[model samples]
Target: MTTSIRGTANADVLTRFRRSAHWKPLEYAFWCLPVLAYFAFPGNYLLLSQIAITGLFALSLDLIFGYAGVISLGHAAFFGVGAYTVGLMGSHGWSDPLLGLLLAALFAGIVGFLSSFLLLRGSDLSRLMVTLGVALMFFELANKLTRITGGVDGLPGITIGPILGVFDFDMFGRTGYIYSVVVLFVLFWLARRLVRSPFGQSLRGIRMNALRMPALGVPVNRRLVKIYTIGAAYAGAAGALLAQTNQFVSLDVLSFQRSADLLLILILGGAGHLYGGLIGAVVFVVLHDQLSDLNPQYWQFWLGLILVLLVLFARGGILGTAQQWIESRRQRTQARQRAGSTS
Candidate 1:
């Protein structure tokens, strides 16, 4: 009974919040909650930084898969290329964060350009296989060239040489977190605009029905190629973000498992929604952190269990579930008020 009362009270508060003039600011505040949490918990700041990068990468995938109807199993190919570009730059003598980002995007774009021919033709299944093959081939090549790629031992000895040669990536993760947040915010702004643009609409139309898009003169394959290139560049930028913050590059960045995990995050959060990637990343990281702290051996099993529950009950994730509950309550309340007035 107490639990039910509290639930009702929470729902009432949410309804009021939705109606309040302060609600708009509060909505923005909600977006910054992760940033606030990072400051609140310094011990977990590093993990948060990583989660943000991964989320951006996943967001790139959502843009393609959910919005553009592109299926890929080798998205990590661009990510790896981005990471390596940064690694290679840092190890040489370059250290400007902004410049490094551009190089990362540029390199990733090149990779996308090269692979788009293979990706542009093929069913979802074929695209998946081809993309997967590309990533795997890249990983293998990196491993084979151990002297340059660092092989299985991974790339180390990378240093960003300080931001603008003044501020360093705070050994405490403060600089890293702030840097990542800034980059993510910029990318997200660009993504927001991209999604609302005419180009974005075309991609959605293509996703809905490639046949219809072309009949309407959308040049379906060309649009797909272009959007896929953009998405790849975004993924690469995400990888570069990680590399800059960590000052290290590893094979794990290119692993099929990493690509698969990003896909899972997208699914867990609901692909078409914007917040899905960010929310999913937070949940995945927090749960992984907590479970690892408790028992690393069984963390995967526990996460698997959570996925099962999410699949069975929460189709839209926590945010989606909350929204549904709130809407349902509003509907019920309005019905009750109408019936009472009639009586």
Candidate 2:
């Protein structure tokens, strides 16, 4: 199976991931550093938490789009389903955090599984239409089911339960941030493990050639279904996290813009790279925050321009470029040393 990276040396990046013992400590620090920073700065809790939630959502897309080569426009369907599930559950006074999370995953997974037939078609344009159609149907349903969904007015007054029956969500947003970060990291770790496993290789193989995989006795369709369901669960879990933090559910949360925004993030981060989704999410959210503060109208325009530049010029996004430059420099230095030693 062909890996995401192109060219000989680029392949080494994925294959030799653990060869550099130096990266081990840094990789550990990468996960730990954020949590540490979150703890250190009380005021930044809300920001960090929200960022993690968005990052998780984007990560879902990365799993499918980046790893599985599947393009989905209806991602918001699962996200919305997860959010509305939480809202519905809260209305019934079912607010245990774990229950909500589990329900979110179940609901999203089912939705994803059901939607896999559409996703399996896998034509870029057809997949877009199918995915977008699903999201639109969900959005309209939310409006039509006013009695249950609260309709356009939104299902307000949701009361999320305390964390593990311990930390009560407060006005200062402490619990929300911590809950989001912890859950986000746990799942993020799971995602990392997933793509590293044999399943991940199967996905890459399927992405490269669906016809060959089935002929070779691999269940191509089944893998697609499994990964789609997993991705949907990730999206749904993200929605649940968002609902728990905000204590409010709105139809807007499941809109096309959310899905579109997530796509932009993954593209910007250079999907297929495990860290790409989060990196893109951070850049996007930070840009949104800063730009919105300056002027809402201009933010979209400027960010859009930046995105065009990225898609056109940056193949691997920021990290990809850095990796390329480092590899190039290393190659040059090695060549120079070899020449001098021979001289």
Candidate 3:
């Protein structure tokens, strides 16, 4: 009986592995796109680097807002925290990039864990207010601490050492672009794994119906706190990457506009999907770049018009709409196939 049960478990594991193997090619292709772009657009590395950072930041917000149903308006608090952590460390002579990144992430995680309690008792609107307040408070605090944070002048003279004791960040941003891409790809992979895991499913369940989750034995508050902290860590890492790549920290990192822009990116890309943040970042950044170049003074108007149309018609943002279209076509094709076979 024991041997038979062990064999059944092995068979189940093999079956699951086989099922998941179908997506391996798609996943490989997805990750390989950045590498292809790296070689294809050598002149556009800086813009690409910025896109990767923005995408990572948006992805962090999606973890809490998209997956856990935690509505926050001050997510930039953690991002700023991470940026300053690296800035201060670099200023004080601990310029090791990898260590700085890890420490920045750790500090941001701690802040998020502490702040999670405040978020637990609020309605979505209240939570928004609380989050915004938290970010504002940090912004003021960073401003006041001029000696350390450099105040309005911004934190200057930040010197980041070579990554992994090699590959220095150069003026053209080639190294930075490759570095940011690698980090984003690794984190994205981990996040993809997480969202496909049981814990991720639980967060989705909580998002769909929090009241129902408790009755189903889910620890709603704990789960929320955990995901929030994880999101904060991711945000921090993104910030750290930005600071290290640029070797500067500014009060703007903690600004309300940063948070709002991130929220807008998520909305534009569509929420509750893993690729939504990345797609949104690309669209938002590229459009902003193009529009601003064309009409600097009235770019906002054009951007607003695009957003309005997107919200009105493409309710699921780009990825969601594309997925729906593809699925519909697939269904129709399958139906035709079945009909022909029957006939």
Candidate 4:
């Protein structure tokens, strides 16, 4: 009787595990799309590479805002810091792309860690103002420090060496695209693991009710600081990739427009979901590319109209809407199955 009971318990555990594993197959298939795109559209590598970098940037934003409920408008600060770190290092003869990426991430992470205290002390509106202020400060600083950042003229003369001393960053952007995609996949995988962990659940709880989290023995502030720092590091790494791939850095890296655009991308893709960033980036970049070519003067107007419609109709963004639709279908099918089984 004891052995039979133990076996039944193990079976129940296995069933629970299998049920929880439903999303894994879908996630794996989603990742495979980029790889397939690389082979299908070889000539569009440069454009695809841009989309990958932008997607990574948006993903970092989603980490803090979507997952941790830390609303920041100055994410571009970390991004600029990362870009400048790589550009300045390359200009000074340390052209190793991998090293530059590491240094950039470290610098940005440190900055995020230090700045997180200020961010943690405020309401959402206050946080927004403070974050925007931080980015503006960085933008002005980069502009004033002409010798290092190159100011309005931009940071030129940046030269990135080959990846692992093997794959050179070619003019065609093949190496750059592959590199960005790989980094994105690795980071996304880590993020997937993180959001599914106990720590991630704590973050979600805090996001739902910060005041109640402290009562539950959750270290709310500490968790926020950690996720913020991690997000900053990811943003920095994305910026470094951009600088290395393009072989240049500009004050635009620190601009408010970049921050705003990133926020838009996150909203378009749907927050609180991992695939939102990737889907939003593809839509935004592709639309921008196609529309600008068609009517550069009025493209912004059309884009704005589209965004207005999305905001009104798709409350959860593209991915969220799609997920909801799929869920509804599954529920309907299950209901029918149950009805038939009863009959």
Alpha-carbon TM-score of each model against the true structure? 0.87, 0.90, 0.92, 0.93
* lDDT of each candidate versus the true structure: 0.83, 0.85, 0.91, 0.91
State the lDDT of candidate 4 residue by residue for 190-298, as single tens digits: 8877876668878889889999999999999999999999999999999998998999999999999999999999999999897898899999999889888999899
Q: Best by TM-score, which number?
A: 4
lDDT (10s digit) by residue, model 3, range 17-124 = 557434567567867878998999898888889999999999999999999989889999999999999999999999998899899989999999999999999788
Off by over 4 Å in 3: 1-24, 338-343
The number of clashing residue pairs in model 4 is 0
Q: Write the per-residue lDDT of candidate 1 for residues 156-256, one digit (tens) a residue.
A: 88878677678788777778877887787788777766766667778889988988777788998888888888888999999998999999999988999
**Given candidate 4, what's the lDDT at residue 207?**
88
Ordered list by lDDT, greatest first: 3, 4, 2, 1
Query: For model 4, which pairs clash?
Result: none
Provide the lowest-lDDT 10-residue window in model 2. 14-23
- Clash number for every model? 0, 0, 0, 0
Better of 3 and 4 by lDDT: 3
Descending-TM-score candidate ranking: 4, 3, 2, 1
Clashing pairs in 1: none
Give model 3's TM-score versus the native structure: 0.92
List candidate 2 segments past 4 Å from native: 1-23, 39-41
